[model samples]
Target: MNKRPSILIVDDEVSNIEILSAVLEEDHDIYFATSGDEAIATARAALPDLILLDVLMPGTDGYEVCTSLKGDPLLADVPVIFTTALGDQEAEVKGLELGAIDYIAKPISPVVVRARVRNHLEMKRMRDDLAKLAVTDALTGLGNRRRLEQALNIETARLALTSGTLSVIILDIDFFKRFNDLYGHTAGDRCLTMVAAALNRAVHHASDLTIRYGGEEFACVLPETEHDRAMDIAHGIRERVEALNIPHSGSDVAATVSVSIGVATAACVPGATPEAWVKAADAELYKAKAAGRNSVSGRTFQVVVEDARPLSSTA
Candidate 1:
């Protein structure tokens, strides 16, 4: 079942909190914070869909809270609505400047509050859906290259901070053009879809992203994975795709459809970039293609230095 939208109601007065909760409780999972400090902490923890902030407070007023929330990357997109008794145009402009989507004046009208909350939440839902579609591949329903890059950037940044490991595997359909030439585009598409599913099944973790990187090329981003584990996964992808037994009468590789895979694992260091990480994997893919198709090649970087340059590499 889908979860209810969550709202954080912030007010120093218990009475105001009660009144707001009474109005919104039926439709939303409500969380409360009594002061600005508590509000920021709760917002980080709860990640509420919308925040109803009371402007006047003892310390860390609503404007300050909104500024803090908007500054945070994770919480920035959350909608914040200021509930202020202050009726001046200047005050309203101040709240809007701090990134609050709408302002609800006190003594809060239940009807107006509900309508505004519903509208903003609906708009947020539409935006979230469109963002998902933008990074998704239309053909095989796998994440597209844009999604791959975004995931890689996120993982690389996180690992760089923690000095952890990251891995990437790039896979190419062996003799794919020949397969299309022999089988026609429809069968070729079917083969690609089957291969995508095989890759999906090969990756076990929720954090592992399998992407259709581009025509006949796919990639996987495995965060915090080691070289041996990544190599095992690369080999697993290769075995699974070949097991599908899609005939490839095109010369060489194998009778059934197969893929060439290359993997690169790195112990992340500061200043690492996603582009450098992908290039390392792509270099290995070239080696796999050079040696022969239908094989897996892997390597490891001892440490990624400034600008994602590897300090050392090992086969």
Candidate 2:
């Protein structure tokens, strides 16, 4: 969608407001607020893409306004820039510390103002795009396995330093081979996408990842979590899959989309290794399959044994 950048200009001086508006008008849809109260009201109603506030405004200066805007979760991500006559080092530092993305000095150069505004907006655009790419699976539009591994590593590192806990889950759709056989490969592709949507919808954490680990299997990684919690997450995954009501002709019930999951956690894996963690998780996964076809099994184990010992204190 082609949309103009929306900017809210807050200043006590009408002349400064007019000057800034003239400078930014071509590149943005400019809105002016002579007082902090009006600025806040306009910001709430329109939710401008960016905000430019004057530091020396009367009754709730830019600093207080910036602080208030940041306190709101909905407004928190909107980048703010301070347009202040106080162009010294101290003012710049204060504005930055208050979470302003950029600082603009007074006697504004149209070129400098335009360049900086465009720069911050472009940077934000790139950042949001990069963040989405990092977490997304290219084929399935689901979270990728790399996302899962990263979440696990962060939790494990935190636990290694502070003795916390972490958990993971490995889920595989049972008899998925028969699904491919009866429905043909193209239908199998649709089945995967449907199941991935269910997994994505079922997961609740921003940090949590739902991965299409490979053909017919998926994984979920949980941080600051334990085996029991992992099991609960797995059950939710299974239930969500079934709730899709996707037909499985080869299975019983005439309508069955199920997964067998293995889950594991570690509070104090005395010695941790990626291999050890995967083995533990896989072992529990096997246990789930052995016990039944549509259930979750939980396991917890201590970390021990690594080839590199004394030198790897980080372990």
Candidate 3:
């Protein structure tokens, strides 16, 4: 709320647009796009904090534009307001039903327009920041366990609805305890950071959440990604870390950093709980360690990490 925000005013009539812009300029970074299409394009480009749209226009009107904006994944969160002279109860109801956050009757007062827009923008900023903190792990700046669980729940539900396929991969740095014992905890911290970056890059899909799974381990929650594809991503992370060539006491690559990975995937189908999905991936990670070290193992392969143990949830 303290930061300056960009606001877009969409109207076909030049005078109405100018008046609204003049009213809002001192409070926000204002942009005007006369047509519905132009407004949507500008909204997307600017990622504006708020949108003031005209209900009646020559071609595409505000309702259609609002629906389209709501349908898009990236633009849906930006709040929209219908600004029109149509004061009927039905018109206001329709505008609200079209996913606009508010409707402002035309013959607009600068005070009303500025006040409502500012209030909604403040709410949007607060909501966004709060949602971010809920999803992020404060310690590592990665997705926390709660966020991971939420992502899995949502993804699993979508898969059932859409019949898509996805994979989850779990990885652990082999013999991390002994390495920490030798090089100290600070070096271990550096290793974790490097692996996190590698995982973030290796998983190219925007839907994927690279999570720090507590300590000495991580998980990649990948959607629309299958088993072979998941293994490919895992191998990519493994190879990249090996290339870093950090010396570790007991790893195959030099000595510093080698990771054992386990990947599990499920199709958009019934009978797959998120817990069961991760259990499969966890089993595979242990197999990688048992088969030796410095490798990527899938649910099909049987490898085991030394002192490998399944983690139980405190919840």
Q: Which model is ahead, 2 or 3, in terms of TM-score?
A: 3
Model 2: CA > 4 A from native: 1-135, 252-255, 268-271, 305-315
**Candidate 1 C-alpha error for residue 44, in Å:** 5.1
Per-residue C-alpha lDDT of model 2 across residues 1-315, encoded as one tens digit per residue: 778888899999999989988988987898889998888878876778889999988898899999988875446778999998786898889888999988888789889998998988888778768967987777688766665555455455445656767677788888888889999988888888888888888778876767877788787767677676777778888888888777888964335768888887877443455455656878888998888678788888877757422212121
Best lDDT goes to which candidate? 1
Look at candidate 1 and give me any clashing residue pairs. none
Model 2 residue pairs with clashes: 269-303, 271-303
Clashes of each: 0, 2, 13
Cα lDDT tens digits, model 1, 1-315, are: 998999999999999999999999999999999999999989877989999999999989989999999976457889999998889899999889889899999999999999999999999999888988998999999998878866776577557767889999999999999999998999999999999999999999988999998999999999999999999999999999989999988849698898988899987767676677688899999999998889999999764355653223111
Candidate 3 ranges with C-alpha deviation above 4 Å: 1-118, 250-254, 270-272, 300-315
Scanning candidate 1 in windows of ten residues, the lowest lDDT window is 306-315
Top TM-score prediction, candidate number: 1
Better of 2 and 3 by lDDT: 3
| CA RMSD of each candidate after superposition | 5.0, 10.0, 8.4
Candidate with the larger TM-score of 1 and 3: 1
